[model samples]
Target: MKKIAILNGPNLDRLGKREPEIYGHTTLADLEASLRAEFAATTSLDFFQSNHEGALIDKIAALADAKFDGIVINGAALTHTSVALRDALAGAHLPTVEVHISNIYKREEFRHTSLTAPVSLAVISGLGLEGYFAAVRFLLKR
Candidate 1:
């Protein structure tokens, strides 16, 4: 089975409550349960969520050290701001898929750019929670 890491950053812990209109009503736990149930037979998944940038970077480094097959990440607000996070992903050299619940293009101008997308194998945006499913599927297929 493929070993995959799902890393969520920043305000994503507020998934259901932060902006139901935008992120939908699925809590992070609910989403994880759904993914686990869907892919239980084919993949081993490890999940981590952190509001701190350094913690996230540390997790990425650990994933690299552990030889994870791929990564599915929803960098949340950090997608638009964190060069360090981008560098960590790039340096890790893992096959990564970046996911976004909201269409960054449809939001503020600052949200239009993603520092992490360039390092990811593909990006899923504007599809709400389905973006996470799509990202995991992409990594699995690879």
Candidate 2:
């Protein structure tokens, strides 16, 4: 079975409460369950989350052995600051899609720039949880 890794970072663990207006009222687990149900018959997914940068990197490094065919990542706050995460994704060399539930560009100036965008195959934003599902579909087509 083909496997995909859905990696989330930082404050995203508290999605439902963190930024209810931007991230929606859905918790991360709730969104995961929906994603699983949506992709259940199509592919297997390994879901992981971490508030620590090293832990996220560690999880991604472990996937270097062809364990995951693709990756959908919501790097959260790290998307703007973490070169380590960007480096890990590039080193993995997998088809990667960066997801963002909110429209970063329309918000604060600080959220406008993404350090990881240069290394990603695609960036899906402003569509909330549906953006993640879109990334999954893109992988399916690939």
Candidate 3:
């Protein structure tokens, strides 16, 4: 089975709690279920979430061996900062799709800038949970 890695960073574990109005009431586990079903016949995915920068980087580093065919990453708040994560992803050299629940451009000025998007094959934002599925489908195409 072709495998994909779904890496979420920073505060994603608090998805439903941190911003219910924006991120919706879907828990991380619930989202995983949705992603699993969405890609059931298409791809097998390993979903991981972390709040620490180093842990997130570790996940990226550990995947450097090409164990996964592609990646769907929601860098969360790290998208705007984290040069280390950017470097790790660049080193991985795998097709990557980045998603955000809320429209970062429309939110805080700080959220307007993303250090990671430029390196991603595609970026999906302002689409809520559906964006995740969009990313899954995108990976399945490749």
Candidate 4:
């Protein structure tokens, strides 16, 4: 099985609760369950979520050290501001996909920019929870 790490940052833990209007009703746990159920046969998924930038960066380093095949990350608000997180992802040298539940471009002007996108193999936006699945599929095929 291919080993993949799913890392969520910042307000993502508030998925189903924080902004039901935009992020939808899918909880973090629900997303994990759905991904696992869909990719169980071929993928070994490890999920991690953190509100702290350091913790998420640490997790990325750990995943790289452990030789994970790929990463699916939704850096939440960090996507716009965290240079350290972007560096961690680039430094990890693992195939990565950045996901956003809502269209960042459609939101605030600040959300339009992603510091992590250049390091990611792909960026999936406006797809809601399906972005995670698409990222995993792309990584798995690669």
Residue 15 of model 1: what lDDT? 84
Decide which is better by lDDT, 2 or 4: 4
Order the candidates by lDDT, highest first.
4, 1, 2, 3
Task: For each candidate in the order shown, give its overall lDDT on alpha carbons.
Answer: 0.93, 0.91, 0.88, 0.95
The 10-residue segment with the lowest total lDDT in model 4: 10-19
Error of 2 at 29 (Å): 0.9
Cα lDDT of model 1 by residue, 58-115, tens digit: 9999999999999999998899999999999999999999998889899999999999
Q: Number of the top candidate by TM-score? A: 4
Residue 46 lDDT in model 4?
100
Cα-lDDT of candidate 3: 0.88
Angstrom error of the Cα, residue 93, model 1: value is 0.8
lDDT per residue for candidate 2 within 1-142, as digits (tens), equals 6799999999988989986977889998999999999999989999999999999999888987856889999999999999999999999888899999998898999999999999899999899899999999998888
Residue 108 lDDT in candidate 2:
93
Global fold similarity of model 4 (TM-score): 0.98
What lDDT tens digits, residue by residue, belong to model 3 across residues 49-124? 9898988788887776857888899999899989998988998888899999999888999999989988899999
Q: List ranges where model 3 is wrong by over 4 Å.
A: none
Judged by lDDT, which candidate is best?
A: 4
- Show model 1 residue runs off by greater than 4 Å: none
TM-score of each: 0.98, 0.97, 0.96, 0.98
Give a tens-digit lDDT track for model 4, residues 10-120.
988898999699999889999999999999999999999999999999999999999999999999999999999999999999999999999998999999999999999
